[model samples]
Target: MMKEQKDNLFILVKSLSKSEKRQFKLYVGRLGVNEDSKFLMLFNILDKLSVYDESVILKKGIVKKQQLSNLKAHLYKQILISLRLNPSHKNIRIQIREQLDFATILYHKGLYKQSLKILDKAKTLAITNEEKNIAYEIVELEKVIESQYITRSLSTRADELIAQAKDLSLQNVLASKLSNLSLELYGLFLKTGYVKNDTEHKRVTQYFYDRLPEYDLHKMGFREKLWLYKAHLWYSFLTLDFIACYKYASKWVALFYENKDMIILNPVFFLKGNHYLLEALFYLRHYKKFKETLFNLEEITKEKWFPLDDNNESLAFLYINNNKFNLHFIEGDFKQGLPLIDNVLKQLEKYKNRIDEHHVMVFYYKIASMYFGAGENEKCIVFLEKIINNKSLQMRADLLSFSRILNLVAHYEAGLDYNLDVLIKSTYKFLIKMEDLYDVQKEFIKFLRGLGDIYPQEVKAAFIELHKKLKQFEHDPYQSRAFLYLDIISWLESKIENKPIDVIIRNKFESQVLKTTFN
Candidate 1:
């Protein structure tokens, strides 16, 4: 049996809308083919399947084992051709490529003049759209045709094409190197998360500077600038410098807005740039700017021409809702955000096939945090257990560590202490295995472990003492992330003041806002 997500044909079929399926059928029958064509029959069979079962496909007798492979390949190619012909799928890049294909055919048929005309138009369209790599190919083809067939402007044509090719090649090389560097930095962030200390920080800084290209910023084109900012954004994120991350992410999103036409052509990059920008604002506690950025993104995505295909729709839902939840956390209004939890979980199931495992786990963590802030300790434990029990999550060691620490805290809060000893021991062992024990975690676990020894009258004093100790780590770069995941300080304040946690956080935020305003 083929893995459903890994099976390209089945996934594509599953992704098609009702209208697209109807169009595919109409396209297949346009040539007056027999209804029983093997490829068409195979397509219908595969489309109807709930999963990719090869045995069931073979059992249908549509094609023999030896012929099944050929039929599948044919059906796949036909589907792509049908999609390319669809108006909804046609973009500037696709249109330029189509013209290039036609020009190649004309050249092979000895129609050199017609081919050259089409190539000229196609090359202009490609360059206008920043499709420089394809434009370079067009220039190369033009050079070959001029050399083989005499033209009226032969004296200047070769020189013009040569200059264009040289410029395009340099731009393409810059884009390629910057894109590769950006991808590597993203991989490093996913694999290990933030740099743990001075040693790790220096190591990551060295790696990033080694791969970064030297360039004149003003001379770089839009594509090159986008990749350059992306590389810098990821590097800043890995260093846990939220301010720098915001700076680069703002530049990235601004580039698209400055060239408004690029938004429609490159919707994915635009959406992602806004997502990262919102994330940085959230971490820096810029509640006003975070709200502004989020609202702007929502408006842009809802535009009439913005692409809302299934894949992008899933992404919009993910990024938009993730920040929505974050906003509630920013104001510490957990109860108000409760309405979004069920809706987000339902969409998670709907998009399970498309979203990755790591992202899904991330959702669970956010949900658990929401429940924790709402003071529903038992429910918080339930959600945290989902992250705790996930054995396959290899990336994001920070999330795993925080989940464990939060789990113990939730257990202690809910008075579910019968198994607390066993849970704390397991968490300690895992922390040692990961070597990610920050001062925050060490003190948190130590406090929880000594709960049985503290006198009832001295509990408030104990809370005050622990709160004072954790305050120092709140400013420590590496340790601050632990607090971001679980606000132990606010929880302790609530205990000492005999007030709700959300009230404590909201009051504190307002006071800080006033201080900044007056200053």
Candidate 2:
């Protein structure tokens, strides 16, 4: 009685598309002896089951209890082999690895000349695609073959191999260091969010510069430059420098465009670079560039050449839709963005296995913000509650903190203020516990906490005062990151102006557009 989620064989079987399952069946029956095989029967049973029940599997009598594990393992391996042989999955990396495999087999069969020939071709393909690590492997294999098979050209070939290996090793080390630094910065951002104070800012700045590897830009290849830009992008994000983020993200995306073939070989990195660029633009409030970038990305992804495998498909959905939400926020057209909410939720479910919980919560938060902008306070509260109540979300303390703060605002707006005091206290406690209670959040909580004491006639003046107080931090280096999460200035303007939040935002957007157009 194993659960479906815990059973890898069941999950794999369930993950297969219709064509894949068909291929698996054909693969099993290719010899005309495996049609009624126990593994095939087990695969069929698992494929048809909605829940993985060991008892039901045993009752089917495909195999005895003691033999079931081995059969399941064999079935899993066979299904994977079939998938590997699928034409759709045969990308450049796979093709190169297949060549390497063929070369290795030939070398083991005492066919050194043929092995060297294949390795030479693979090494060229790998180097051209910036697959330096695999290219290094090919060179090592060639070195072994050359040393054992004495030939007239062995001296020059050995020197060439040694030089190539040295160059590739240096590039690989540089890329690895930069990628490691980028990942570490990203992890830090997820765990605790942007630098909260001067102390934190200095710490992050020091950490970034200390670990950043030294490399000559002119001598660097596409892969090294890509990782270099990625490292800088993450550092900029953690430091809340939107301008720097945009600069590096632009460089990252440009690198791909300059080497178009690399885009096909490294679609994931290409997608991420564009996504980060869009994010930086969104934060900088560069409306025109953001729209253009989003449009370009959407068009590229729609192209037939763009990889649409499950992983890339999920990422495209996540990045594109996440930015679509931002686009509505930018335009203050939350009502129009409402349609995207249902579509995104459905896709989220479809790609649930590929999308992580952190990203799902991010989508939820964006949806909640959209509802808030549209003045659907109750619906906003409903979505915010999802993030606030999620106990397992260990990342993005910033998101969780703001979710609670936004929840309080939505609850107050929805006239659920009977428990306002309780909600405010709990939110305050939560922020304090996360050590994320900055000036913006503190001022917000204090204003909400004092709302009960203000007379109805004085509420407008209170709103004005709060707006004035919070406006100072709108440009503050350390505190402005809070505004990125929740646009409190616009919300307060909506209150003071006695208009809908979306109206305030729309007016602001129009002014910015006109300013950009004129300037």
Candidate 3:
């Protein structure tokens, strides 16, 4: 009895769209004998099943128990082949590979001239699309063919092939190194979050610069430069350098704009670059620029040629909607943003299999934040509980820590203080366990802990005192990240001023806009 998650074939069958399943059936039916084959029967059984029960599969009489594994594997491969033939799945990379496959077949059949011609066109297309690895493969194939089927210009052709291969190989190596460094930094950011103090900062700085490969910018192509910018962006993020993040993210997005055609060829990277740019702007509180960037991204997605594949669609939904929430947060219009929660949640459910748990939790946190700002403390607590109670969400320790802290605040605001002491203790302990107890969090917890002891008449004074204390770290490199997660200062101001949290935040936003406008 294989676990549902571990059953690859079952998962694949379940993931298929109706059109895709129809195509698969038609693909198998093309071979009249395969219409009733054991593998086809297995596919049908897996497709109809809501759960991957090996015993149920055996009872279906598709194949013998001992032979089931082989049959499942065959079905998986055939389904993939069908998908590969689907027109929507045939992007430039796949097209290039298809050409390479055709060339390889021809080369093996002694059609050397024909093979060389196909390889030449494929190498050009690959290079144009910045698929350097495949371009190198095409060049290597051409060289092999040239050695066996010599022409009058063999000497010059050999030199040209060798040069192209060398350049492509170098570019691929550089891209690989940069991509590896970027992935490592991203993993570190996820595992422990941003560097907490100067010691962690120095360690991460050293780790980043040590692995960052040297390359001449002028000589680098789109693929190499894309990875280079990504590495820098991750490094800036880990070091809590918002300006640097903006710089690298801007460069990343600009690279695509400079080469507009590459946007279609590398839509995922384009979407990610824009997302990071928006994130950096959000952190910087650059409202004008953030709005402009978000608008531009939304418009880009609406363009005629933009990809609408499932993966791209899921990411577009994730990044665009996530930032739309951020936009509302920056403007302090949480009430207006509340309507978006239902749609976002619906999309999250629709793409649950595509989006990861970490992002889903982030969405929950944003929803909770919106509710909190809108003065809907009970609603806020409900969403925060989703994140706080997620025991298996191991990534984004920072998010988990803030979710608990926000949960405590929501409870206090809603006057659910009967269990406040117990909640405070658990949250403090959890923060300590996560090693995420920054000064801001400590101050917050300390204030909440003493709330029960304060007289009702002195509560406003307590709020003012707590506001003064937390305001000092509003710009602190390490501690300020906590404020980005939960805007305690505004919450305190709302309490002291006897106003709603949204009113306080909206006033602050208006003042900042005025200041920016005057400046």
Candidate 4:
């Protein structure tokens, strides 16, 4: 009678909830407290251990295909009946379709919000039916969404989802489910947004950040593991998250540097170089000690070859930024750098894929600046046209800056005969809309400087107004354009009322014009 009564109690516990069911499993499986008390304590304990191990094996992807197939066959039938009764419970269907359909789409598209939304709606629908049987499935899918978001540094939603997933995953004999979810969360964090934001407010939500390394070190065999370090490095660079950036970069470098021979052909090297260059640029901009490291990096990069695609093209952009720094700030033979720029663009173009559209536009922009600097106006105009025509270039602040400068140069060289007014006005409009007032003033200065040579007092007043506006940014690096302004001033001042033009101004103008013929 006692044994039969215990069996009835066990059946009641199993139907209550997942958490209650787990408590029952633990009490029965671990404490040797079976309904059938006929067994010796040790025998009951051993049986419980066997059941625990069986649960572990089932959870760890170790179950036989036939066994899972049989289990799934029965479970699906129950799930279908539950769904039929509570068809409105999207959470039920989402849970069942997670790994199979609905959740997979969310994962593929990086849409975590939609995944959880579907699961929550389904859960609400399932509440009406006690036998929904979707409790386990919903729990697992919810965990995946939560873990994935947490790993990606989508901290805004992570904490809430994690709390909910953890509660559900830990319910009942869901230890195996919890363990799998934990591993996945750890792995996805490593694989995606490994680094959190640089700002203080953003880091507060990450509860599991500290536990990740412990988890990662244990599951190092996972292929996507390497990407965790890479993602962290990229995130650091993106958010300017320096301390974490350096920490992860050192870890990543150490990982590959020792086994450099093994992964020399791997895509990670390009990723590493990208990391190094970006970090170097950050340190080079903000700190001083990294210069020597930056110098040695150039040598390491020389030994490496890049394929002509997006990754290699990123290296090309790094080269462009570094070269611009060298040209404008370092005070070297800027012309000597042109060959290297040309070589990179040629390599990118060799791929013949449109993936390099932005890179190519950048190349054209740089070349235009270089030619304009050399007074090769016609050549500058050709490259400027390339930049203006590329449809892929996003009209961001940087692109707007480049566009305005190029347009000013193009219009000045094209002269009034070419209806250059249209180009100049369009450039002014773009800069004004972007709130790039400083560039707009520079364009105006260039325009007045170009025309001030021909029309004296009226254009001279325009130049004076531009100089007044420009004076505000006197320490600005772009004030270097003042050199041209000075030249224009000198030329205008040197002109006598009756003189044809100063011989010196004529000579300077002719020399500038001559360079354009073959450039």
Candidate 5:
């Protein structure tokens, strides 16, 4: 019976169009097979994905709209079938029954409410108690969608769906689903502008942190296993448990050696870059002694570990964030970063004009961020303004925040305070709104502090208000919350006193806060 199914799967893959092949790969990914047949099937699936990607590129180049739509439909159906067919792989099956295919499509279409509704149903479709593990994707995706939509001014329905999803997830219908959901929620809270007092943020991280080490991170193959460890790493980070985060992250890094073949099969180098950057950033902000640890990772790889094309440029941003200029840019020689950024920009421009406006917007924002980092301030402002002016409020929220925060500092430094007060006011409103939704609160607060620093007299009242809010947070103390309070208060003090963050503050943060979580 299994042999017949394998043969049929191969045939189905071959008969499908290029788009169908890509969709099939997603489904094929769900089923587990340790034997020769599964391996062969996986190979076939990869071949199909390659073909499909080629076709997509070629079709895209030719500006073939009709053909593209046809290909997309074919691919979409394949995705649906694949998602629907993986019962033996419990997680995949639950995702299917939960209607992830439909939800994903709706999300792409900008119909977040509809997508979330399907995802909500997906949370309840699991059978065995373990099946509940898959619901987290829906829950987290819903939060992302909600944040995206709310930031834009869409109807705020994400909380309702999240509530529904969380209720089911806590019942233990599926372990992996619950774990993944908790992690996803943690990420969403961080991504959105949520405060540490945000109940959802606290609850999700606490639940997952307490349940760490139960996930056998080595069991579920590379991609899946990497994600599991990644979740634990994040949970540890949120709980201000740097030791725990680092321990899991180090274990995950070591797994790269044992399952090197699997590591080579995925584009995890980018992930490693991000992980290292996170460590470096945390250490820099906290343990200044480990600041040199940032330079440890190399610039390029001889190992073609993954099939990422020009996107490596985006990955290099991790290095950039770590301030490891030599690895990516030797003596300011940006030959590598420049070309990569250019390629990504071209892709974004092409997608913007043709494929999808929303995708174009995302790429546009990424390009703008690159430009800002590269000191192309004029170009950054142009793209940033364009995105902020986009009709979508959700879109405008991030774009506005990014543009205003960076440029606001420059303007203040230059003493170009024409209407700076109004800009700061609007910015605070946006950040506060985001904070309420459990969105990017840490970043928003950081920006608020930055504004207070650049124009102390102008933002004094607002800074005091923010300080008051931070003070109230002391009543509700999670590890992450404690860190946030300290960071914010330090920022406030620096702003009030017209001073800079000294080494002592950094040392205390590293020793008393960050190291406690990740070491």
Candidate 6:
């Protein structure tokens, strides 16, 4: 019973769209013999079901107990065939494969000339699309056909096939290596986040160089360049170098634009590249480029040619909304960003199953920041509490540390100072455990711990002292990732200048606009 609920076909069926279900039925009905067949009945039964229950199937008498697995398997195969024929699933790779399948059928029928012609066209298509693995397969089939038949360039055909196969093989191998290195580096980033100190930086730097693959830029193709840029972007992220991130992420997105079709075919990567690019811009405080990139990405997604399946749609929501928050943050328009909260939360709920925990928490952090900037200290604590109370959030130690730190600040802002000392001690111990006690965190925590000692008249002096201490680390690369979460510099300036933090940040934003105008 449990196995039935967890079956792959059941999950696939549950994930199918209404149009897919309709097409599948028409496909099954195309054969008169299948009009009332057991497998079709099983598919119909499964289609209506939210959960797969073998007992329910048994109750329907779709098939005998001994033959149930066979019927389900047959139904699964038929559904996939229907999906393959669906227009939405047709892409360059699938089109080439279909042509190859036709050629194989022709070859089996002894029509060697026809088979060779189809293979020739498919090979060109595959090569043009960077489907080199398919290109290699097509070449092998051509070679096999050529060995049995006569052709105009028989003498040079063997040489041509050998050369094409060798070239495609090398490109495929390079693409695989770069892609693997990118995946491994991504794994490391997710596991440990950015380098915390000199030791971590040295270790990650050595690890990256050790696993990095060698390839000539002049000979690299779109796929190879895409993965290569991804590898560098991950390395830049791990090193906490926003400038390098912007550089590589720009290349990543540029690679897609060079072949706009790939933006449709590889929409997930396209969305992610833009997301990372916007993040880099945000970190570097380039509000203008961030807005432009985000706007351009949204326009691209709106195009009819964009391929937006369930997965792509979920990612679109994740990336587009994330940068939307970043735009608001950089512009210091927290209240203007308010309307996005309800819509984003609703979409987050809808896409929660597709999104991972880390991303969801990242959204919460941003929303909390939005509320914090808007002077909703109580609401800010509400969002921060979600992160604070989440015991399962063990990764992203910086997130955890800052959440605790933010919680302390929010509590103080709310005049919930009765438990401030306890919260401060608890946050201090947590930071110590995470080993994230850097200059900014230490200054903030020390000030909070001694907030009781500072008289009301001397509060401005205390803020000044801590602000001066944190200013030293503003440009410190090792400690800068912290500011990416909470803009301590602007927040401190708000206190020092006796204005709301949002006002200080907004003034800075206006200054940026003025700077751009003059430039």
Ranking by lDDT: 2, 3, 1, 6, 5, 4
Displacement of the residue 16 alpha carbon in candidate 2, Å: 2.1
> Which lDDT tens digits does candidate 6 get at residues 338-457?
999999999997775578888898898889999999888898888888888887765577777888888888888779999899999999998888777877888889889999998999
lDDT string, candidate 2, 50-118, tens digits: 877898999998899999999989989999999998888899899999999999999999999899899
TM-score of each: 0.94, 0.97, 0.95, 0.39, 0.43, 0.88
lDDT of each: 0.89, 0.92, 0.91, 0.46, 0.50, 0.87
Kindly report the root-mean-square deviation of model 5 from the true structure over all alpha carbons. 17.9
Please provide, for model 4 over 1-519, each residue's C-alpha lDDT reduced to its tens digit, 9 standing for 90 to 100: 422222222222222334433443454456554555322222223234412233433444534645754544443343344433332333333444443356557756989877777767666544332213354466566767677676545675567556655544433223333334345543443333222223422452253344333333453422233445655554454343456667766666566555554233343454454455445444433223244445544555545442333344446445534444333222223345456556655665543332346545655666665554444567767777777766665533545455555556455544633655566567667656755454435545465446634554575465455556555554443332333222233223333222222344445445644664556
lDDT of 3 by residue, 349-396 (tens): 888778999999899999999999988999999988888877776868
Candidate whose TM-score is highest: 2
Cα lDDT over the full model 1: 0.89
Which residue segments of model 2 deviate by more than 4 Å?
1-6, 64-66
- Please state every model's RMSD to the true fold in angstroms: 2.3, 1.8, 2.2, 24.0, 17.9, 3.6
- Which tens-of-lDDT digit does each residue in 118-180 have in candidate 1? 999999999888888899999999988888789577878878989999999999999999999
Q: Comparing 1 and 2 by lDDT, which wins?
A: 2
After superposition, the stretches of candidate 6 with alpha carbons farther than 4 Å from their true spots are 1-11, 31-77, 105-112, 150-155, 388-394, 452-458
Candidate 5 local distance difference test against the native: 0.50
Superior by lDDT: candidate 4 or candidate 6: 6
